[model samples]
Target: MDPTFLSAVQLAALVRGGKIGALELLDHFIGRAERLDSRINAIVVRDFDRARQRARALDNQADKSAPLFGVPATVKESFDVAGLPTTRGHAALKDATVRVSTLPVRRLEAAGAVIFGKTNVPVDLADWQSYNPVYGVTSNPWSTAHTPGGSSGGSAAALAAGLTGFEMGTDIGGSIRVPAHFCGVFGHKPSWGLLPNYGDPATSSAAGTDIACLGPMSRSAADLQAGLEILAGPDPDETALTLNLPAPRATALKGLRAAVWADQAGIAADPETTAAMLALADALEREGAIVSRSARPALDPLDAYHLYLKLLDAAWSGRLTEETLASRRRDLARLKDSDQSADAVMLRMTDVPHRLWLGLNEQRFRLRRAWTAFFREWDVLLCPAFATAALPHRQDGNTWERRITVGGREIAYNDLLFWPGLTGGYHLPATVAPIAATQAGLPLGVQIAGPIHGDRTTIGAAALIEQALGGFKPPPGW
Candidate 1:
C-alpha cells in the first residue's frame, strides 16, 4: 500500500507487522524529502546518515513493539537534536552545536522513532510566518503563496505535504494549533506541567515555562494521543515524581456536552470562520451530542486576553535581544498610564516587576478556577483557532507593527492573539481539528478546549468529530 498520507499509528503498525523493514521505512521518507521537499521547504536540516544507522539497529532488535517503532519523524528546528544546530532560525547561532539531545528528543529516540531531520521556524519563533536568514520561507502545501502557520509552520507544512511520518512542535502562542488549523491537520496542546520542556533555545532550566509546552501535530487525533503517551511524563531530573493522565472521558459522542463560542465581543472573527464553527456545532447536535451556544465561562474575554498578554510578555521576556528590550522599555516610558491597547500592555509588561507579577499570578489562579467550574458543566468548548484561514507570506517589518484585514476590518496583527491566548493563558488543554474550508479553499480549524487536565475529553471530542464529519484531507494536487 502507498503510505503517502497514512497516519503515524498506521505506519508503526506496518513496521510491527513486518510489512516494511525499519531502515526501508526511514529511506522511504528520506527519498520523498529529497525529491519533493523543494516546493514546501519544510525539512531544513537533514541527518540522513545517522537516522539510517539507527533504523538499521532497530530492524535487528528481537522485540519490535515500541509505541513508535520505526516511525520516521522530524521535530521543530528549535528543539535540540545532539549534533544538529539549535538555531531557532537565527544565522548567528547556526554554528553552535548542541552537546546533548533535549529531553523530548531523547525520549522519542528511546521510544523507537528515527528522527531523520529538523524542520524550519521563524526567527526566535516570534512570528506566524516561518522565514529567517538561516532558512528560507516555508510555504503551505495547499497554496505556495500562503504560510503554513508558524513557529511550527514547517512542521504543519511537512505533514500536509506528506513528507514525514510524525512531528512534534512547541507552542507558546498558537505555534502548534495555528499551523495545524492552516494546514488542515490535527494538534494537541497538553495541560501545563503535563510534559517536560527542557530543550529550549537559551536556557536549560528544569522548571517549565509559564505558557509554553511541547506537544504533537499530526494527520490524526489518534496520532496525537499516541504521541502524548510517548512524550508526556515527569522531568527525568525529578526522579521521585510520576505522571498518570486519565483516559478519555467519552467513549462515544452520544452524551457529550459541547459548548460553542464562535465569536467573542472584543475579538472580530471572519464571518466565514464563525459560520464554519456554528456549522460544526450543528453537526454535533445531529450526532446525539449535547450542544450549547449560549453557555459562557462568565469571565470577560478582553480582561482575560489582556492578562494573558502580560504573562506572555514576562514568560518570553528573557528571549528578546537586548536592543529589542531596550526599545520596548523606552517606548514604555512614553506611554500614558491610561493606555491599555494590546501593544501598550505588551510593552509595559516586558520588564514587569516581580511584585506586580505576584498580583497577576493571583488573578490568574482565580480565572483558572472559573474555567474549572465552567468545564464541570460542559465537556469541551469549541471556538475558532484563529480569526481566519492561513494568510499569505508576511515577511515585512516587525510583526507587532504589521496590520492585516480580517472580516473586512483592519486590525493590528498581534491583536489576533485573543483566540489563542484566551484558553492558553489559564493553562487549559486544547486540541485543533479540521472541520471546514473557506470558499477560497483555505482550511478552517475549530479549537476544542477543555478544563485543565481535561486533555482526554477534548481529544475524545475531536475523535468524535472526525468519525462523524471527516478528518485531515490532503491539499489539492498532492
Candidate 2:
C-alpha cells in the first residue's frame, strides 16, 4: 500500500491492524526521502539504521495502541536525537553530537513513532528562510524557487513533499505556522509551556523563555492533535501534576462564534490571502456559525507589536555575547524613545533590565487577559498567517536590510512577525490551516487563535475548517 499521503494516525492504524508492518512503513518513508529529499533538501540527517531496528522490534509486539505507533517522522534539527548533532544549523557545532535525547523526542519515541532523520533549519534557527552553511537550503515543494518557511522550513517541506509522515518544530515568530501556511499543511502552535523543552539545545536552560514554544507540524489536523497528546504535559521532573487539555468548545462548526481579522491597520495581507480569509468567514457564516469581521481584542496593534518585539528580543538575549550587549546598550542610549524603527526596538530590548522585563511580563499578562475576555465572546479568531504566500528564496546574507513584497509593495522583513506575534507574544494557542492558494499555486493559510490553554479549541476549529475545505493537497510533481 502507498503510505505517501496518509496521515501518521492512519499509518499507525494500518500498522495496528496488521495490514502493514512497522518496518515496511519505515522503509517506504526512508526510500521516499532518499529519492526525493535531494530536490527540497528537507531531511538533512539520516538515522535509518536504528530506526529500522526499532521498527522491526515493534512489529513483534501485539499491543500497538500508541497514537503514532510505527509511523515514520522527522524532527527539526534543533531537537536532540541521541548521538546525532543537535546543531541549530551552526557550522561550528556541525560535528558536535548530543549525548541524550530531548524530552519531546523521547516522548514521541515512547508513543511508537519511528523518527528516522533530522530536518534542515536556519543558522541558529533565527531566519524565516531555512538555509545554513551546514545543510544548505530547503525549498518549498510547491515551487523550488520559493522557500518552505523556516526555521522549521525543512520539516514543512518534507511533509509537503511526501518525504515524512509528521514533524515537530519550535515556534517563536511563526516558525511553525508560517511553514504550514507556505507548505499547505496543518501546524499547531500549542499554548505556551504546554510542551516541555527539556533537552533541546537552544532551550535547555533552567528556566525556559516565555515566547518560544515547541509544537507539532503535520499534513492533517488529526495528526497534529495526536502528536500534541503524546508531547504535551508537565516535564518529566514535574510528575506531581498532569496536563488535562480542555476539550474543544464545540465539535461542529455551527453555533461557533468566529472573529475574522483579515488585515490590521499597518499590515496588509496579499489580495489572495485577504480573499481567502473573507471566503472562510463567509463559509462559516453560511454554515450557521456567527462570524464577525470587525471584532478585535482590546489591545492596540502598534502596542502589541512593540510589546512582542521587546519580549521576543529579550527572550533571545541569552544568545548575545557580553560585548554585543554592551555595544547595543551604547547604541540604545544614543537613541531617543521616539525612535520606533525595527532596529531601534531590537537594540533597546537586547539588554532589557530586570525591572523593565518585569513590566513587559505584566503587559503580556494583561494581553493574555484581553485575549481571554475576547475568547469568552468569540470561540476563535481567524486571521492571516502571513502577509503573503511562500516567498522566493532570498539569501543575500544581510537579513536586516532585506525586504519582502506583499501586495506589490515592499515592506520590512520583520513585519512578517506581526500576525504570528499577535498570539505568540501573548502566549495564546494558534493553529494554521490552509484555506486557499495564490494565483501561482502557492498555498495561503489562516491562523485560528484561541484563548490561552485552549489549544484543543484552535485545533478543533482547524479540523472543522479542513472538513469544510479540504486540507493538505500535495504539490504538483511531488
Candidate 3:
C-alpha cells in the first residue's frame, strides 16, 4: 500500500499489525520528503539519523498500543526539539540550539512518534507567508506560486504534499487554522491552557497570555483527535492539576445544532468562500442537523474585533524593545480618538498600564462568558477560515503595507485575523476542515468553533463534516 497518503492512525495500525515495519515506515517518509521537499520547502530541518535510530528502537519493542506508535511526524520550527534550532525563522537566532525538548515534543515522542524534522515559519511568525533569511519561502503544494499560509505554513504544506503523517503547531493569530485552510488539511486550536507551553521560548515565561495555544495539525480529523489525546494534560511542574475534557456532545450528525456565520458586516469574505460555507450548512440541514444562519452571541462584531486586537497586541507587547515601545507611544499620542484602524489599535494597546490591561482582561473574560452562553444553544459555529483561498506568494518586504484583494476590494493584510480571532481571542476551541475548492481549484475551508474546553466537540463536528464531504485530497502530481 502507498504510505504517503495514509493517515497517522492508519500508519500506526499497520505498524502494530506488522503489516509494515516501523523503521521501514520512517524510511518511506524520509525518502519521500527528500525527493519532494525541495519543491515545497516544508521540512527545512531534517533529523533523519535520529529518526532512524528511534524507529529501530521502536521496532524492537513488544508493546505497540500507543496511539501514535511508530508514526513519523514533523513539528513547526518554533517548537524546541533538543539539539535543533528554534529560530522561529529569525536569521540571527538561526544558529541558536535548544538543549531541552518542548513539552509537546516530549509528549509526542512518549506516544511513540518519531519526529524527524521541523517545518518552516515566517520571520518571528508575524506574517501570513512563510519566508525567512534562514529558510526560503514555503510554497503551496497545490500551486507553487501561492503560499501555504504562514507561521504554521510549512506544517500544512508538508501535510498537503504527503511529506509527513502529522504535525503540531502553535496558534496565536490563526497560525494553525489559516495554514490548514489554505493547504486543505486539518488543524485544531485547543482551549486556552489545554496544552502545556513549557520550553517554548516565545511563551515560556508568559503566564497570563491565554490567547496563544498549541495544538495538532494533520491531514485527517481522526489524526487530530489522536494527536490531541497524546498532548493534552497539565504541565509537569503543575503536578497537582489534572485535566478531564468531556467527550463530544454527540457522535453523529443527526439532531446537531449548528450556527453559520459566513460574512460579518465589516469583514467581506470572497463569494466563493461564502458559497462554500453556506453549502456546508445546507448539507448539514439535509442531514437532519438544525442549522441557523442568523444566530449570534449578542456581542457586536466590531466591538469583539476591537477587543481581540487590543488583547492580542497586549499579549505580544512583551517582545517589543524599549526603543520600539517609545516609538509606539509617540505614535499613540498622535492618534485621534476616531482612529480605529488595526495599526492604531495596536499602537494604543501596546505597553498599556497594568490597570488598563486589567480592564481589557476583564472585558475579555466577559466576551468569553458571552461565547460560553451562546454555545449552550449551538453545537458548533461554522464560518469561513479566511476571506479567500490560498493566495499567490506576496513577499514584497513591508507586511504592514501589504494588501490582499478580497472580492475585488483591497484590504489590510492583517484583516485575515478577524475570523480566527473571534474564537482565539475568547479562548474557544476551533477546528479547520476543508470543505470545497475555488474556481481556480485552490482549497477553501470552514472553521468549527466551540465553547471553552470544547476541543472534542469542535473536532467531532469537523470529523463529521470531513466524512460527509471527503477530506485531505492530495495535490496533483504530489
Model 3 per-residue lDDT tens digits across residues 281-358: 999999989999999997988899889988888888877789988877887788899966676677777667899989
| TM-score, every prediction | 0.98, 0.97, 0.97
Clash counts per candidate, in order, are 0, 0, 0
Model 1 TM-score on a 0 to 1 scale: 0.98
Residue pairs in candidate 2 whose N, alpha carbon or C atoms collide under 3 angstroms: none
Q: Which TM-score value belongs to model 2? A: 0.97
Task: At residue 459, give the lDDT of candidate 2.
Answer: 95
Q: Which stretches of candidate 3 lie over 4 Å from their true place?
A: 200-203, 206-208, 333-337
Question: Global lDDT for candidate 2?
Answer: 0.89
Supply the global lDDT for candidate 3. 0.89
Whole-model lDDT per candidate: 0.89, 0.89, 0.89
List ranges where model 2 is wrong by over 4 Å.
200-203, 326-339
Clashing pairs in 1: none
Tens digit of per-residue lDDT, candidate 2, span 285-395: 898899999999998988988899888898888888888778777877788988675666777776557999999899889888888999999999999888889989999
* Residue 477 displacement in candidate 2 (angstroms): 0.6
